[model samples]
Target: MSQVIGTVLSALGRLGMIGAIMAAFGVGLAGTIYLSLRSPEVEVPDIVSKDRFDGEATLRDSGLNVRIRASRYKADAKPGTILDQSPRAGEVVKVGQTIAVVLSREPKEGEAPAGRDEDADDAANAESSRGGSSDTNKNDNQNRNQRSKNVNRNTVNKNANKNTANQNAGNRNANTNRIANRNANVANRNNNQNTNNRNAVRNIANVNRRAPTPATTPANPAGNRP
Candidate 1:
């Protein structure tokens, strides 16, 4: 009976030792599993519909690095709101991981789009060319008008000079004609006075000669009679 009791005590001691060893092994395995499962990563949060500053802040709070990818125009979407994101929301990523995003903005009224900058530059160049052309045309017109005015003035001055010369020439001709007529009248008066004096002298001489002849004839007749 003593031997059986000793044997039974020995078996109980062995079972207790086994149980303790199993429990220790189980605890070690559980600790390893928990450690292996743990990671230093967080979920990427959704920042859509948030303002640009607010979205970046939220991304930073969610253990992410924020970067702007691009901007887009969405007519129905909110202006200056987060539009899209890389590494979509709820995706597990390492802490301080960069998240690229696209920002959204509505097109303004009468505002040109970003894609139209080159076209706008071309339009501006064309408009400048047109303006330059218009200015050139205006300058040409002004020059022509000024030249026309000058020509007209010159023509008027020439006509005036011509008229003055003709009038002077007519006056000179009239003066010459008057001088010639006065000289002719003076010559004619002198000739008439010389002719009248000659005729009077001849008549007196003839009358005196006739008187002498008659007196001589009467003397001769008286002598003969005596």
Candidate 2:
């Protein structure tokens, strides 16, 4: 039993350093492997000068998450631009770490220059409206002028027709008067001829009545002395 114990102790003493060295090597190898498999840190990109969407995309492409945590008004800066970042520009961070950012806010209501453009648009619309009304009025005036012109032409035509009718009536009256005067002159000539014939017949009858008794007495004495 003493010799067996001695042999066992000697064998253990010889194998212990080898086992320790192997264990140490194995641990070191495992640690190296673990380190190799771990993801490396990345530098945060400078996104302050970039648009928010562009910055966010750039961070995402670099294996980082992005968070828009707040916004501040900046009239000099472009709207929606990255203003500031936490874990600021050129910061080293692990993969999937979030880069918090503040963005510039857009101009608020009643403070935008777009209102001026709208006012210009309104002015343009008003001008167009006025122009349209003027055009309408002009058209109405043109139509009225045309109507007046037509009325004047119609009146002139009617007067011309009336004058033509009056002239024709005057001509007919002149013709009728001439024919009446001619008929009266013909009747007077016929009456004068008839009176002359009657006077001649009356004179012949008076001469016969004055000479009849003396003529009968002279013819009886030439035929018989008694």
Candidate 3:
């Protein structure tokens, strides 16, 4: 009986020692896990405008993880370039914290180029200026044509009026000449009629003087002799 009790007690004692050792090991493991969970804080670096691969490498070197929040088209930035970051540079964060970043991509088809709006406006203004000048020249040509037409019309009218006045003067002179010729014809007819009447009166007077003297002397002598 005494030997059996000794064996049982020794076995019990060994079991208690093993339990204690196991408990100690468990506590040490728990402490190590808690310490590891509490990581050191670090400052965020400036990775904007860097290449995506280079930025990721930089973040890894700083004991940080990267998260691509979005991608967008950029005219000036190269494709796969890092354009922005959250929890910006110099901000303190825990190690292994994730950084959100925006990456650049090529512009889609039909997208306009950046910084060219002013050039387009300048071109449009130049075209408008040329159009205005062309319109002005057209208007000037029209005015010149109208003025020339007016001058030609006035010249034609002046020539017509001068011809009419000359025709009227010619008609008046012709009428005056006709009246003078008619008066001269009337005067010549009157002079010829007066000369014919005087010649007839002298012939009658000569015949009577030559025939009456003989007849009157014979009558007076016969009256005295009978």
Q: Highest lDDT: which candidate? A: 3
lDDT value, residue 90 of candidate 2: 77
> Candidate 2: where is the Cα deviation over 4 Å?
1-131, 212-226
lDDT measured at residue 15 in model 2 versus the true structure, 0 to 100: 100
* Model 3 pairs whose backbones collide: none
lDDT of 2 by residue, 1-226 (tens): 9999999999998899899999999999999778756968998888876998999899999899987766656667788888667666676777777877767777776664333454344334433533444566899999999999999999999999999999999999999999999999999999998999999899999888887574444467557667
Give candidate 3's TM-score: 0.36
**C-alpha positional error of residue 184 in candidate 1 after TM-score superposition, expressed in Å:** 0.6
Roughly what TM-score does model 2 have, to 2 decimal places? 0.39
Model 3 CA deviation exceeding 4 Å by range:
1-132, 200-225
Error of 2 at 204 (Å): 2.1
Ranked candidates (lDDT, high to low): 3, 2, 1
Worst 10 contiguous positions by lDDT, candidate 1: 122-131
lDDT (CA) for every model shown?
0.78, 0.78, 0.81
lDDT, model 1: 0.78
After TM-score superposition, the amount by which residue 19's alpha carbon in candidate 1 deviates from its true location, in angstroms, is 99
Error of 3 at 172 (Å): 0.9
